[model samples]
Target: MSAPNIPSSAQRGKPSAIPGSSPAPVPGPNRSGNTKTSAPHQEQSTAQSPQLISVQTPTGGGAIQGIGEKFAAQPATGTATLTIPISATEARPGGTPSLALGYSSGSGNAPFGIGWSLNIGSITRRVSKGRPQYQPRSEGTFARIERVTHQDGPGNVHWRVTSRDNALSAYGRNSSSRIHFASKGNKNIFSWLLCETYDVSGNAISFVYKSEDDQGIDLNAVNERNHAILRGSVGSYFSRALPPLDFDYIAAATGERIARSVVKEVDWESLENLPEGVTGPLYQWLDLHEEGLEAVFAVQGGSWFYKRNQSAAGTVSSLENSTLSRTVTLEPTKVVNRMPNVSDTEKPRFGQWDVFPPFELWPSGIDIGNPNVRFIDLTGDGRADILITEDQILTYHVSLGYSGYGAPRSVHKRTDEERGPRVLFSDVDESVYFTNLSGDGTSDLCRVRNGENCYWPNLGCGRFGVKVTMNGSPYFDRPEAFTQKRVLMTDINGSGATDIIYVRSEGVTLHFNNSGNGWAKVEHLPSYFLPPIDTLASITATNLMGNGTNCLVWSSSAASDTCSPLKYINFNNGIKPHLHVKITNNIGKETNLSYLPSTTFYLRDELEGKHS
Candidate 1:
């Protein structure tokens, strides 16, 4: 046979394999009979070194071809490239190999009898046969190869194998080749096989074959089931795996299972009852139901207590029969006011005082500036209670109850001590008296007839007069007394016991009973600057500064420019002795003055040396 020669064009550029033709097997005798051949022919084996299969066929006047090999002799270890070439004829001396069957002409056909070349690049080998391998490539190989197939005569097939792998692994042997060709093992099962088997909707997955039929399967239900399984199998794994779900969402998704579980685990009865119109989690119900529970409490207390109907207004007669009772009654009586009485010689003595009036006072009767007293249930019992004060006495009568005043009783004979039958008065001149001094709790009765004439007038001119204790009764020893004067009871030293502040015309004295005996004098200010003996002076102790023990005396004298109307005197331990006085004119204008201890006395021109 004549040796094949390369054409001039073939010499300029590499020629591709002929379409519908395979490379000629090495020309030698077949060695399949287990016999040794010549030295040059010994290298060829009948097994063909697992030769790669390639096929090509003509379709629509064009060729279809496939070019592949058994990867490398070994598994592809790393990245490799593959290249293939195709042509209608092989360029050589005399004649080139050509396909001349019923080939249709097309625009896609290559010139010079239709040559084609493909390049595959960067093939990486993954786990296969538990070994690292790679695909091979030829020089100037493209990044990818598109396969085309062709058919030959009598259903015959042919292929043109690529030289890319051979070129790229030129220095390597069969097993060590750096380049390889595509193979069945290179396909990823997960990406190609399993992934193709499923249809995707958002994040959910369904069988591709059954996707249409299972379109209505609730994904939420599947998620809940998955969550339950995962939460159970992995010890609360779903709690960590999934985003936290709201309680209501969980309950709705799980269809009462979550609620039942929570109910079974939680103490429902111990929790407060939920309010009306409230739903969902117990905590939400509790929060929403608080006002409803409070309303329930109010309703249970009484229908009349919080009722607003006119029938429920006025007099709630139903309440009287019920636990609720009226708290006050009124009666008509003659009013009187008696002055201090004279002694046997008809001289006005300090001891023999007259019986004050049993005034028919209104329930709201009191001076404008004085504290008011009203008939109220001090002990919370449903009964009428009596409260008496200097300006008013309230006598509650549930028996003859009315919204206004009740029935009156006949005038009964008064006790000798009372001088005649009369309404109880808080400012009785006698030893025993009752008043709501601090405006808290019930009215307290104070008696002052236990000590001796330790009430000497020279000790201090009693502006409101003094009452000597007649008997040594401990209950009456302290003589809880209140004049029209302002008295303050406080424990300045922080002891549990209380001390008394007695403000009189002469001075301000603090009587602290350190041992609960007679009043021991702790502080005695000879006098607080005032207009005169009686100028409607009002004294109050207030802690103006934030310090715990510093007390300031707020006092007001006669409301005139000549009379200092307001004063702030500091009575703390460390502050310099000074008095801040504010005077007001007849028209209610004011002036302020700061008086230190060094301030000299001011002589009044009208009073003649009596310091003002």
Candidate 2:
């Protein structure tokens, strides 16, 4: 009847909908059948073009006062938009008062209202935004208080301090303070200091030095002052007043008393406090402790006495200079107690090193560090056993795994006088090898000399059978070259049987063993150049690469300083072979790895020196 009261394009600020185009509005409720009609004659327009929906009351006086879009066309695909103009009256059907679209209370079809639509579970009140409220903090008796500004929030922050706790220890206390004893980690001394905890603010000033005659200084007042109260020279002659004693703080600060302790000097003839068998005059010093002061008297001759907490009686202890070195020629620089602070209650009565179970030295009187003692495996077990040669007897200690070793037992004896080897060769011309020459996975002894070679097959349990004389070989022809270090035994060709390697200035000769009795094969690898005899330290044959074939690692003597030029020669299964030779020059000593036992092999890893 009234053309649906649609506004003009100019008034709505948009172009009219196309005649046959689809309504591309955003997806929402399909309010097609929900449109309202006022009068019986107000039959809904049946046109398929886009049109506005208008509502009227039963009296037909005024229609719902607003403009709204009604979907009369088909929906299509495209970005769609709708301009919702706020209405002063009812804008859309089912919308609340002053609202364009109605909101449902819950999942069901409930009508819209002015109240909040979101069902916040059991919450009945609305959430409003405001600054958080905090309960005020109680202010205690503050020694020093100040207002600290807050970085955030509205008001100026008011901060208060009650008191600062005193330091429990003087570990980091200032050296200038009289009450602050000299502690270990005082950085002011410029000395190297180490500590678990340190504070640069100095010790929390305490009342130990505070005086009552003069106005008593509070903890805050003392903390505010960092300079020393009394400054002067140290020792017997001081430019200022003497340092305050326990009760002298008040007198010292006010100059009320120049009281001093009685000084006494005793002659050496009256030294009745000396420990038994100890000579004196012992040098005395006051040593400070955490709990109290201690009087210490020590001497360079190896005796010390201590009186703890000013006690009348003192304790005496030995400060003997001890060493762990095996040699007696060179004197040690200094003796340091590594565990100096270990309490007496934690130490054994005889000392930690006095007696160790399971690892006790055998034979009772023998020195374990004796050069004649050797650690090796006579048995097939992986653990190392002990071998001691004294007089002419060879004593063996079988390893019982980690539990320690079995009792010492005699394994063998030398028929050629206890001096060494035979009188003809001497010890220098004899080289002995402990290896699996018999191919039985057990080590056998082989003695090689300039004139003759002997093989003693291991019978088991550290016992050997009769010695078999080996055929004379040209490898040991020179008595000078037949020394113990000139010969090396190893598994050269991945065979379980051991092989012998004879090193000389000219080259190296490798001999393959034949059933632990004789040499089956021999190969000579010429040296690229002869190594300097004085600089040559040792030549080792070990399975460096973990491969079955062993490698020759020649090292220079420790007397050589400069880098030793190295040449590597790999002899792989007798194929294309290479040799490694190192020549050293005078400069710095190189660490010799020959000290490592022959029973063990050095593992060659990727981290090995490229030149080695």
Candidate 3:
């Protein structure tokens, strides 16, 4: 036969068959059954030998592609490498989750594709160069959104978010918009905003979206209660900035350093009229000034109150912690002289100083402006309350149940008195009187009294004014003289009608309400019915054992004693109740509101300034 034209290791002048001393010289026959190794293929023990790995199968060219180690002679060890990848959203195999190797023996000892129980759950490594990352085998890669935050406030809200990815060269941009009214956490779940306008801040590899929208619509109840409409506003005011989420997107474009810039007073406005169909809370402004005096008014819950400033001057602004020292005296500076739009419904029927919530007078030393103070329940809580007004500001004070007054508080603030529409009378001295003087079920208030007035000096606006009403309609024509001092009221006789106690030029006169329109100054009682009272505190009607009928209990600074003390007296029949006539049975001793202090142990607070 002619010489076969087939290519072989010998024909190509290359060592094949696993290339290591010719496979340790496998036995071969010399054209016979017996075999012998070729001389040139014998293994040699030399220090110059090269390290070689004998793969089970010999490969042609690419069977073992990129490894470039030339073998001169067989040595001891070998080295080879295999690789795989994992992508985002992709996970490794469940059962073995491990990487390993495998082997096989076949043609001339080449590696069997890197044996691996390695099931190598396919990982999507970046298919292109430059921007490489591990992703889900399904789509190869994905983008990231980070540094998201939503700040909620009473007025408006703000949001911040960023879209990013490992591949700076990715073709698409990231985006999302959402509105947040409350707090929410981030997990697999995320939220979005509405009515939002976005302003892009950074690049796509890490594009940031900062958005804002008004939440006034959410605080409808607050606005209405405050008597103002919180319409959509142009800007927002934040107390502080929301902290960043991703620690990477810093200046390095990582998540960490992405900070939210701080913003300040975008000054908000409350429109008086709300758009139609939009229902809001009950917003109403009430005039709380006393009958003829300049007063400050404020609404607390369901009641109206006034702030008692030192000078009884004009109001200025509202306060944060009304309980604090509310005595911000206007220093006599031209405080805004705004007054009450005193609707017939808002004037003070200034109840009896005792029946009203009372506050301690600015005592001898503490001067908080107007040392002259009076008591009346502006909020109708049955306590002797005080309404203090100054600089157009109003405050409310209720008894603290501890024989003292609570911290006068003003919830809201108003700066300029000029902004409001009413005018206050700085000089009128006629005190107010609220009572059911007539047998009628409805009560009336004679806040301002004037019937052809002349006497009472105009200490303030000095305007001689008159006309009083209760619950709106005019009740009666009270003479200016009747209001010179507070008018006391009670059912004097067994008659269930409300009567009036007037102190006139003549001693004290008792005007008995006929329960209708006429007033009869009854002189039928004992020769001396009225007593000499110094400074009366409170007056309560109760049944005293003396008269065997309902009577009145009262406390006052004793004529001979500076220490205010309590006393009791009854009227005619035990049939009905009226205020007590204290001067009758008392000549000396009575327990006071405060406990007497002992010089033996600790000194009493009342014992500080004066002795009675």
Candidate lDDT (C-alpha), each: 0.26, 0.37, 0.29
Off by over 4 Å in 1: 1-377, 380-385, 388-423, 426-428, 431-443, 448-498, 513-518, 528-536, 541-554, 557-564, 569-612
- Give a tens-digit lDDT track for model 3, residues 181-256: 2212321112322212122322121222243232111111100012233686688777643221111110110111
Candidate 3 local lDDT, residue 488: 51
Q: Write the per-residue lDDT of candidate 2 for residues 1-612, one digit (tens) a residue.
A: 122333323234344444454544554445685545322122234675455544322343333232442211113421112222223323222221222332211111111211112211110111121112233344463334333344553232333333344212221122222211112232112111111111234423221223221121111111212335466776675454322211100010001110111111112222233222111234332332212222233444443344321111111132133111111011112222333221122223311222223443334555555756666776655656777765556777886653556788884464743212222212444556666766656666667665556666654445565566655344543754456666777766544567777777666676766545466545655554434433334455643222224545443424341233221233452121111112111122111110111111221111133223
How far does residue 62 in candidate 1 sit from its true spot (Å)?
99
Q: lDDT (0-100) at residue 414 of candidate 2?
A: 47
**TM-score of every model?**
0.21, 0.32, 0.22
Best by TM-score: 2
Q: Candidate 1 at residue 471, lDDT? A: 26
Candidates 2 and 3, the one with greater lDDT: 2
Candidate RMSDs in order: 46.5, 41.7, 36.4
Question: Order the candidates by lDDT, highest first — what do you get?
Answer: 2, 3, 1
**Position 447, candidate 1: lDDT:** 42
Q: Top model by lDDT, which number? A: 2
- Assess candidate 1 and give its lDDT: 0.26
